[model samples]
Target: MDVALQALTVLAAIALGVRTKGLTVGLWGAAGVLVLVWVFGLPPGSVPTSAIFVIFAVVTAAGAMQAAGGIDYLVGIAQRVIRAHPNQVTFIAPYVAWLFATGAGTGFVYYSILPVIYEVAYGNKVRPERPMAIAPTASQMGITSSPVSSAMAIMVGLMAPLGFEITNILSIVLPSTAIAIGAAAFVQNKIGKPLDRDPVYQARLAAGEVTAPEPVDIGVASASAKRSTWIFGTGILLILAFGIFEGLRPVIPGADGPEPLAMTTMIQIIMLIVALVILLWCRTRSADVPRAQVFRSGMSAIIALWGVSWLANTFIAANEDSIVEGLGGIADNAPIFIAVALFIVAALTTSQSSATIAIIPIGITLGLEPWQLTAMWMAVIGLYTFPINGSQLATIELDATGSTRISRFVIYHSFTIGMLVMAVVSVLVGLGIGGIFYG
Candidate 1:
């Protein structure tokens, strides 16, 4: 009875949080923590300080890059590519979107290229939905694979203690997610009616509701833009080098033997250095960094992670024994339940970092192996299962031809099939790769 009541309290807090996004989710989570500690007499859990620092560091670098026009530089390149391969927009557009988000460490970059994608496809008479719907979905998938993303920060923090490295995580996620996007694009290319045959599009065309999309103007990349992008890319490569070849990092004397610097500390230091270099070399004003969209979104993510992770850790710590005993059998007999739980939580939270911080600890407590958890990590992409995501809504609005749309049944929106296919394929592919590594 006590455990059930406590679980109900956690659920209620999550419900309220999901209803009001941004800082409110964190506020509600803090409220839940208050109730749990004061009312239920539950002891507090350790704060996720390491994960928070990682997010702050990575976001700082990404924000600095954005402030220096690095994002614009990348978008210009994407525009050129899309325009160059107008006939293959459906097959090529999602990959470009995925690469942009992956490189920028934020999905907001996808918004810049959406217009280009729509213009290229609509101009070519290709069904706009074919590329428009899946492009944003592919952008979200990139977060799971991004080395500097908030979701990756939380994931690396969680798995590091278990002897896994960032390379291990990326090895499974990058290939799986890339392959998943291709599979989804192939399927999406077949589903929607061709632009000319679609009745709604034709009707809109006849009524003058659809106008020819204006050509996207991709201006030349500035010196600062090019400099910042190169600096940021170098930072990412350095981090990967450190992860892949531990010998590259400095060895510090320890209580036992000299050990290489910790990856978390290395990452924080590297990202901070990257930010400083961008500010100096790119001539970006310090004031502009905080105002960048990546900074704002990343800061908001930190708060949500702080509050929700605290609330969840507290509740789980208080009831760890009960939860493990109750669910351990299922975890052993049917490990897939672990992935399903992650998917459902991600869908409910609608924030990849929030979902990761909240549920991954519970999976750890359930005695699941790190490789097993990593194999299922891509399931967090389920955040797009609902059409309420900003990226999805933006995709719909950007399509002047009205091919990208939300169905009356919200679940049946334009992104559903692509999102579903990507989720299933990524997880399956991740499992296959994980087996080769740790099976």
Candidate 2:
């Protein structure tokens, strides 16, 4: 009865989400599942870690940045770049995708840039679907190995018990970042040209499809006109140095590389602080939004992801054995299956951190190299680049005119196809790659 009720509750949550597209309700669904399983003693673990502190910190940091006018500034800069080079739209698209993925999480990254994407589609007669697909898909590419990503952090934590070393991880997994990025660009070129030829896309561009963007009210930050570009560069250098060393820490025989060396959260905190200091020193202006409003934006961004992640973790924790068995069957012979499974999980959960927490531990038990597991991580990142992501939601709020037309399915499937292509690549080279990593 407990198991049945749990399953029913999970189904209800999913059904509700599908019907309303309400992330909040989906979270409730996860909570219900947790109640059924945890309170009823269905799953094996004692209790899933709430990870509330992590979520709170991420939200606070985001809110602080918004208060400082960071996101508005990003949007302004992105808009200008897109407007300046409509022709390079395909080429520059990845950078735009990467930027959103970096801090905002892939789904929210998709949400944040929707207006820009829609406008670019309108201006260039670009098939918004393909570029839309490309952008979101690209955003997911980062998550598998991004030091800053919460999902990556979760993996770091989950595997900490196993003494997984970061240096060992880098040699095996870091290469995938380059591969994933290249794969996204390659797929975009292949898929994007076809989208351009679609009659609907052509017709829409001919109709002058205008996504009514919110008026840009922010002050312009001269990215080029700054002595502190050097300071900015220095800060970035420091952050990277910190991150690289942190990534290497898991492999160190003893804990002496840098005192408190493993705390990468500190590295990012410092990075954000330095970014602010340099921006101020350079007198870099922010977008027109007030500081308070900016903080609100950041709070929105963080919560956009935080709620979904917390809920999903709760659900997976409740139905873990079932979830694990369902997913684990393919984990070994079906790396591709694991990848696809994560995409759906990410899409359903609408947050990679949640999906990663739900899935990766099971994946590890099913047998994965921490390195190859990294590739699997990329698959999840790609999945969340769907329209359901937070930034995509935020972007929708920007364009009241509804110029952005790709439905949730289109964004999800485009990324799905990208995942398939990567799977194909892995299959073709599976033996070679597998031998190198797992053997």
Candidate 3:
């Protein structure tokens, strides 16, 4: 009873922090930690140094790429590809979102291309909500698939003890997510009336209330832009390749004899080196690095993780025995319910990486199978459960048809169906595939 109350207090603080987002959420996380120590007499938890470092390195590299116009260059290519296939907006758009997030190692990259996604979908007379709703979800799905994403970095590190490798995680999630996206796209396409037929859209159009969205000028890709973009792209490929083929990494002598490089260390080293190469090769001004969208968002994520994960870790560690003993039977009897816990945590934290950092450790000590955990790990993509995220907000704003909107009740919004569809499909597919691999 005492432990449960303390846990609820910590969660209440997090809830308060989420209500006042930005740096405040992190501050709330800090308060939760402080309360645990000061009031509950719990020892301090170790900060997630490795996860934070990996996040910094990834952001620095991604920021350098953005500063060098690499993002614009890629967006230009996406625009061209998307433009050529405007008729397939729903199908091609999600993959485009997935690809950008996969390479950039952050879903926030979806912002750059979202306007383009909106334009293509709307101009082609396709329902804007279809692409808008699913694109962000797909980007998040891509995070689990991204080798260097902080969520994957933390997950891989946590599952290593269970004899899981990065490749194993990828093999299950990548295909599972692809199938899930396809399923969501099919369902999304059939959801709403056509733009011409939607009474709300027709009324808005007839009233001349619809405004033409300004075109994004991905200025002509220069030599430097192309070079930087290639560097970033190559770095992504190398990370994935090295992750898949451990032999590519040089083995070094250790107490255990010659051993392959650790993935966490490898990710940090590769990303920072990639940043350095991009800085020199692309001639990016150093001053613009912090100002880049990826840098700012990445830092926000780092702070959130540092506070929330640390606080949650402390509380859980202090009460591990009781938690495991109490929840063990339920977990054993209904292993799949772990996804619900993950989903709820993500909804509260509003960050997949942060949620994974905070909750996966507890799940690990629950003695769940590596494959089961990895498959259900897709649940952290529940950023839309709260409907207050930037991507969701931006999606609502971009839809001139007013068809994409949040309900007055807040949770019954445009993204509700899409979110539920992807979450369910991904988990089901993941479980089936995971069972095959780990069974």
Q: Where is model 3 poorest over a 10-residue stretch in terms of lDDT?
A: 211-220
Would you list the rank order by lDDT, best first? 1, 3, 2
Tens digits of per-residue lDDT, candidate 3, 311-338, equal: 8888888998998998899889998878
- CA shift of 202, model 1, Å: 1.6
Candidate 1 collision pairs: none
**lDDT of model 3 at position 294:** 82
Model 2: per-residue Cα lDDT over 189-246, one tens digit each: 5564444466654564578874433433436755433333344335435545654566
Query: Model 2 segments beyond 4 Å from truth?
Result: 1-30, 37-39, 42-52, 76-85, 103-128, 143-145, 165-177, 190-198, 201-219, 222-240, 246-261, 264-332, 382-439
Give the winner by TM-score: 1
Better of 1 and 2 by lDDT: 1
The reply for model 1, stretches above 4 Å from the true place, is 253-256
Candidate numbers, best TM-score first, in rank order: 1, 3, 2
In model 3, which regions exceed 4 Å deviation?
Answer: 211-216, 253-257
The lDDT per prediction is: 0.89, 0.51, 0.83
